[model samples]
Target: MQILDTYLTKAIANNDTRIPWGSLKYLIGEVMYGGQAIDNFDRRVLRTYMNEYMGDFIFDTFQPFYFHHSPDVSYYIPTTQVDAQQQGLPMKEMCLGISR
Candidate 1:
């Protein structure tokens, strides 16, 4: 977030805050998913998901952000941020799968 904030600050100073979508996508995918990606196929899938989620069109009001669009499991991006406390899920519930 600090790096992103610095990037935003620099862009603002230059009076051009338009984000470079391609670079943003690559950097985010590399940072967030690169280590977890086990193989070429995994990397390709990660890139594809990043391409879908990270784009300028995300800011368009008419564009619908769907993480997954299917008959069985449909998920969309939340319009507003919710506090962790407000979510009412306990820490164990939230991080259910992995034992720490």
Candidate 2:
């Protein structure tokens, strides 16, 4: 959880919505869960946690992230958890409000 918190901070600071394959693999496969040697099952569980829970609380722009993996790589991108209408404010409104 702490590792994910740290990475979340970095991701927010970097405004990075697209996390690469290597980073996710390292975080979940090696660094997390007592650093135990993990297999496919562990990976799926971690991925699900990120998708279902972590996604709800991460950065506003990048909220609802999930692992998108292929045969060779894994990545995280924004999920379709909430529709655009449900978001806080539109980009235009936010920009206009910022001028105040």
Best by lDDT: 1
Per-model CA lDDT versus the true structure: 0.66, 0.53
Give residue 48's lDDT in candidate 2 (0 to 100). Answer: 57
The candidate that achieves the highest TM-score relative to the unseen native structure: 1
lDDT of 2 by residue, 1-100 (tens): 7887788799889988775445655576557753453677866765655454343344556443333345754344434644552463334423222232
TM-scores of the candidates are 0.56, 0.34
Superposition error at 79 for model 1 (Å): 6.0
Q: What are the RMSD figures for all models against the true structure?
A: 5.1, 14.9
Compute the lDDT for candidate 2.
0.53
